[model samples]
Target chain A: MRLGAALRSELSKLFRQRGTYAGFVVVLALVGLLTWGSHYHQDRFKVANELGPDFVVAGKSITALFIARAAMDVAMVILMPVLVAIVVGGLVAGERQSGTLRTLLTRPVRRSTVLLSKLVAGCIYAVAVTLFLGLSSLALGYLVFGWGDLVLFRGGLAILGPQAGLLRLAEGYGLAAAAMCAVGVLALMLSVLFDNPLTAAGLTIAVLLVSGMIEFMPYFEQIRPYLFTTNLPMYRACLKASVDTASISISALYLLGYVSAMVLVALWVFSRRDVTC
Target chain B: MSASSVIETEGLTKHFGHIRAVDGLDLSVHAGAIFVHAGAIFGFLGPNGAGKSTTIRMLTGLLRPTGGEARVLGRPIRDRLRVGRSIGALVDEPAFYPYLTARQNLRLLASLSGGARAEEIQEALKLVGLDQDADRKLHTFSHGMRQRLGIAQALVPRPRLLILDEPASGLDPEGLAEVRDLLRRLSEEGMTIFLSSHLLGEVEQLCTDVGVISHGKLIAQGAVGGLLAGGGPAVRLRVDDARKALSVLADLPNVMAAATGDGSIEVGGERDSAQLNELLVRAGVRVYELRPAHRTLESFYLETMRAGKSNDRPDAEKAENDNDGSG
Candidate 1:
């Protein structure tokens, strides 16, 4: 019951802040831009150029699924992770800097309970923002461009029917949301360690950027598979004509392990830490 | 720990690196009665950096003590959540989300403490005279308003004990009186309040009991009236031939004498005014008038701090006045 009340309180605070809506608005605007840009310049599309003039990429072929997939590629790789970091970074450090953590800790609620509630709330926000981006891009794309069979260039060229395409899109979104949740939890851990929200959020982004660099660089090839960033784009596995369940499962387990480890470290530090602020 | 005490500490200490913010010190506050004060309003007094806030933080479970132990409401301080159930604390300064309204802030805080009814929040607002501004955002609140809201939050959960730090720091005289009245009413209803403040006058008026700490050690603790009475009697006198009188009174043992601004002599330490008069007269100094002097809590506090310092170091400076002894 205490945990429930704390969760409710946490969620209420998260939603009431104007910054929370700013993330969604930004996501929607980006999706809208991407869809409009794709509509006006279909011939310039990379998929069209790769497939040559034999397969026209204009009109009925530029579907909602394509827009969502394009948006996810950009959003999950960069935009969503940064947004998630900013939101989760403020969870503990912002309160500490503002001197509100002292107020919150003095209450009858357990420190572990408070940390758990915040983690759950951050995860909820991650899922909500991820789904909003996916659905909003799909809707805006459909409004501008008509639906059609989904074409794929990932792995090998294999066309999918509308039903199978939508299923793949949903699966991709779910995996991306799970990855973003891992980022949020990682930010939460940084928030516990730092007193300044900006420092925590900036450090989380730096970690993301450096990890992304390591994942793509040839110098880090030996350790590429071990990096969490290497697995962050595992959602692309769902987009393939023949999904690699084994690889996706490994990535999912790695993310789950990362989140669990972050949660435990956060809870331990928060419980024993002094609230001098 | 006594059964009637609501707070008890044995050698409670907190060391921040090399600085001992709170040294090994023992403290106690009774539940409702049988303490120094008739009511259970424990006023923790100390000079700046004297560890009053550190002690209050430990009692409220905001800081961990380096050594020793403390218990609030019969539970050890380590059981913070349990101890928090019966105590409402406002540590350091009152802080809330600037975008949140007064009512919303209260509701958020209330939900953390097992929840509070809307009526309870309203009543707390009314008590703090913020009922009309309950819907207003906290960003618009002044410091005095924030202090009042801090007190109101402590009352929202209707806890058995209220621990406040500097509860009257920024209040005007009018606000001070209103808060004084509110605290008096709360005490009348049997709430044990432990507060730390630099407002000696307000503490004198509102608190039944006070503990004075200096250099991280508690030097004095007792009823307001009893502690003040312990200063002993001081006598003011008007004497003819002030030079001779000073010379004559110097011969008297254990008597401290100083001249007042109005050309009269004030003497303390020795209770009897008549003996001094006779001794001065026989020594060729005429004694004109003699009367007892009044000592205030401020004077007592300064004198105790002086004495505490002197005792802490043998080479310390002498007291400003001869009568200024640690009571």
Candidate 2:
């Protein structure tokens, strides 16, 4: 019951801040711009290849499903994590900086309960952002380019019919949201460690960027599997002609592990901390 | 712990690395009639850096004591959630979300503590005289307004015990008067208030029980009246001839010191007023009035602090004073 009250309070505060809506606006604008750019470039390519079926690109249909899948790729990789980092990173550290955490903690609530409420709130926000990104991109893509079979360039090219493609898109969004939730929890852990929200968010994004760089380096290939960022792009597995259940399960498990470890550490530190400062 | 005590601590100590912020302090505050009057205001007094705030923090469970135990409302201090439910506190300065309005901020806190109704929030605002500006964002509030809003937030839960740390720190004279009146009203309504302040005059006027701490130790804690009757009971004798009366009182064994005041003799010692009057009459000095003179809490506090700074234990000094009176 106390957790529910804390969650409601947290969500109310989150919504009142302009930054929350600003994040949503940024996501929509970026996805819209990406959709327009893809449409314009696809038109140019079609005009350029109008006379030559011999030189045409094979198995690359520009459908609504394809556009949404492409948008999710960018959203999951960059936009989603950054947005979640800003929101979740500010959950604890920002309150501390402003001296509201002292007031909040003085209420008739346990420290662990407050931390859990924030984690739940962050996860809800992550899912909301993911759904918004998916639905908006899908609707905008349909308006611009009609829906059809999805042709994805994975494992030497794979294709899915329109109905199956929609289901895969939903599954892809779910996986991407799970990845974002892991990022949110990691950022929240950093938030509990630091007194400044900006530092927490900056460090979380820095870690992600550095980890992404390391994941692609041939010299660091051996360590790639251990990095949490390695599993973020696994949403692509949902777009395969034959979904890789084992690979998806592995990615989900990796995210869950990261979330559990970070949350446990966060709870431990926050519970033992002296809020007098 | 006594059954009537609302707060009790034994050797409560808090050390911050090398600095001992609060050291081996024992304190007890009784439930109703805190010292002299029912639901009276208890003031925790100390000079700056004297651990008054630190002690308040520990009692409120904001800081953990390193060496001892404390209980509030008959529960251990470590039971924060249970203890917190019965108490409302304003630690240091009031802090709220700058983007949220006063009402919204109170509502948010209320919700976290098991959901205070909207009417309760409004009532709290009215009590603090912030009802007219309840909708204004806190960033736009003056410091005094915010202080009042802080008090309002504390009141929203209708807590049985209210602990305030320098509640009058940022208030002007009018705001100070309003807070004093509000606190008195709350006390009349049967709410226990424990506040800490360096404002001696405010404490003297508003508090019934006071604890004075110096160098991280409680130098004195008692009824405000008892503490103010410093050294021992004395009487101011308004006599026809002040010098003559002083000369006569100087010869008496019970009179500790006697000096002429404004057309009166200010006598200090354990001599009874009746005996002093009889002596003045037998000595042919006409006594107009013989009234007990009480020392101000300010003078007592200053004396205690001075004695503490001179490497003299306050309790020993107080014991010496008590012995002087008995002898």
Candidate 3:
């Protein structure tokens, strides 16, 4: 009965968050315009500096492409957790705060079923949102910018093979999604632990923010390698000269550890909680 | 206990540190009977700390009793999940997602309960008289309507037993009447109803049997008419002439006292109405009313509350139990 009809109950609540829709629209507009403008700048410089009288430009036109690519990469990382905090944080706390938990628990379902169902729904939303970002980038990069060759970083600049690049993009998305999923679960668990949604969301975001700072510290780098927040950006490593999967794998394991712990705690608390509100 | 009994609780004791919300209590609710608990209405009742809510929560598998046992349909309280399919309870104020329409809320509850169909949700809505306003968001419902919707949601699955906590608290007079009729209809169809309330008059009218719990203990329990029939208080005998009936009863042997009211004589102690009636007729006094004149559950519950004593009955425990769900 946990995941029973209440799963849809949570789902409907998620869709009701006006911020989610707003976030989607904002992401699309910014990413689309950024990619197109980058694409425009790339072609204009090529036609002017190379095809123009001087004929100075060579193979790839270097006009704002790096900035656009970097912006896209950063946007991808920021999109997942930033846009999803409210949904994830509200999972249990929102219901508890609003007294819906009593309504939900009165039904005949296991507590774990309810938590798992909500986790699965959050995963679905995360996948969809991340994919939206990735696809929009691909659209701008190919259709508008013209898919001749993609510039790169790491050791030295070199163009990427689309087949290989696309795979790397997907892998990065997966790693990032898994990391965000853990964050979402952490927020949900906190939601269960706390009675206020604002408290849960605030604490969750604060944890990620503080951990990110510690991971960047000179001495904490080693410990940082174990943090899920640190590994969130590891997806970019897929495009680096020497791909080191060691950190990504470590991050995945750590994310899994946090997710399980949070889920277990949530069930333990909810099962015994009295409907006091 | 007869086969007509549906819910029986024995020595249902629950303690929280120094406070006992519910203490040594024994209760039996007969099948096809609407039983009410009224001691809880005027002031705090149940164990000082182990409240009756704790008891209901344990029965619903939401909490574990400190010391006690309860049975429904002869099934002991355990983790078997049998009650999930049969029991519907509103232990206290019920909550629902404010954004969801009443119909959506019921449908979802049905699906979660494992066997509730969409049609059953509709039936439940109709049963609670909520069909006309089923589509409204729960936030917009008045307190009374919210209470009705809560009832509708619980009944959606059509469980064998329905536990309502103050189900009519928020209803207006008309709404209360509707609920009274609805409960009667349900019980007529053989559904067991256990409702808790503070309205003695209403409970006395709606419930066939009544149980009084004070300080977490069931002080008195029985059929409405039976409990009212016996007493340790004044009895008023209405007859053609109060003076004649008083004189006939005054002549009875070992008579302690007698007082006359309009067309009646109030008697106390040594002689009962039957003995008093025999003396009246011998004295040539025409007697019409010889029944106990002032027996009511309302006054009975008040007496129990004033006494502060409770029942210490214990129920049989579940032989085997297994509750292994997420929460």
Candidate 4:
């Protein structure tokens, strides 16, 4: 019941802040542009398929289906972090700065419940915002680019039949949204650790960037599976019909551990913390 | 008094790192009475850094005491939510969300509290005199308005024990009078108000009892009447036949002093002046004037505060002249 109240309060807080809604609009616009560009640069009327159809691309019949499908998957992967940060960065630190939290805690509510509410709300925001971008992009893509064979992108492509392309898009976006939820949780943890929003965002982004860089270094081939960020874009790899699920699943488990540990720390620290200061 | 205790603490101490904010302190607040702790209005009243605020924080479950037992509603004060539900405290300045209007802020608070109703919120706002300004953003309201709003917010929860630490900090004369009246009304309705202020006069008027803390230790605690009327309100009894009357009046326990008043005898500090006059007449002495006399509460306060301060002075250097004390 307490957690339910906190969740309700968090929802009101998320929508009440002008900055949050404004950022949501900007995120939709940016993702919409990316989604539109995937089809705008090329003529979707010209179709090329190895099995049946062919199109002239530089006088050679090329499979542009694979390229457009790759673009959609890439857009989902890239938009997840920045959009997720908007939800994650204000979970705790912003409350501390704003002083409304003092009145909240003075009530008969526990600190753990407050943080728990924030985490659940962060999850909601993450999933909702990511999916909103995905659906907007997909609708815009179809409206402008028209439907084509959805090519699954990893290395070699599996051409999803036109009838199954929308379903494929939904499944791909689901995986992307799930990845962003983990990112949101991670960012929420960072928000709890620091008082300044900008610092929390910088630190979370830095962790992601450093982990991504270290995982890509050729010398550390054995460490890629262990790096959380390496698994971060692993959802994009899910577009392939056949791929190793073991590493991506393991990364998800590791991400869960990191998120749980950070949230627990936030709860523990906040529980006994003297909010008077 | 034992059954009436609402809050009790025995040597409750809290140390933040190496600094002792609240030292070994013992206090008990009786239910249905206004209890005030004086020594911190202009900030120099309480024990210097003894953690009076810390003690209030611990009592409100904002901070866990490092040592000693502190009980509110007869239970330990660790579980903040349970303890918080029973207590409403304005430990320091009222912090509010600047962007929100006073009413909106109260609405959010009421939602967070035990329960919220339109009538309760409006009632609380009216009690604190913030109803007229309820629609104004908190930033536009003056400090006194915010202080009253804080009182309203603290009272909105309808806590069993209202713990207001410096609730009157920013108020002017009219505002202070309003707070005093509100507290008087609340106490009359059986709400135990434990308020702290540096204004001795204000506490003297509002509180039925009081406690003084210095350097994290409670130096004094007693009923305001006892502290004021401790000498039992010196009474003068004039009667003819000085010899027998002085002896007879001295024999009575309540009379602290007996002397001849002109040709008549004088009996002072007789708790029951009427009874003493009756006794003198029954003793076959013609009684003339029989009336109680003493300094006012203000004079008594100044004297007691002076005595309490010089309490540590050498015995020979101390003076106990009732007349000279206030002087």
* Residues B176-230, model 4: lDDT tens digits: 9999999888877767778777676788777777766654566666777776667
Q: Encode model 1's per-residue lDDT on A1-277: one tens digit a residue.
A: 4899999989988999999899999999999889989988886765767676687555356788889888998888789999999999999999999998898888988889999999999999999999999999989988887676777777877677888888888999999999999999999999999999999999999998999888788998998887878887778898776789899999888878877888899999998888887
In candidate 4, how many Å is residue A105 off? 1.6
lDDT tens digits, residue span A74-169, model 3: 775555576666667777788777777766766777767877777777766666676676676666556555554445555534455556555656
Candidate structures ordered by lDDT, highest first: 1, 2, 4, 3
Clashes of each: 1, 0, 28, 6
After best superposition, candidate 1 residue B311: deviation in angstroms? 3.2
In the order shown, the candidates' Cα RMSDs to the true structure are: 6.0, 8.3, 9.5, 11.9
| Top-scoring candidate (lDDT) | 1
CAPRI tier for the interface of model 2: medium
State the fraction of real interface contacts model 3 keeps.
0.57
| Selected candidate, larger lDDT, 1 vs 4 | 1
lDDT tens string, model 4, A211-248?
Answer: 88898799988987777787676566556655456766
In TM-score terms, candidate 1 sits at 0.88
**Chain B TM-score of predicted candidate 2 relative to the true chain B:** 0.76
lDDT of 1 by residue, B1-327 (tens): 675568788788887665666777787644222242324898889887788888888888878899987877778989988899898899988998888999999999999998899999999999999999999999999999999999998887998889999999899999999999999999899898888988888998988888888766788887888887874876777877887786776667766565554687666565577788788888887777777777556656765775677576321122212113432
Q: What's the lDDT for residue A183 in model 1?
A: 93
TM-score for each prediction?
0.88, 0.83, 0.76, 0.74
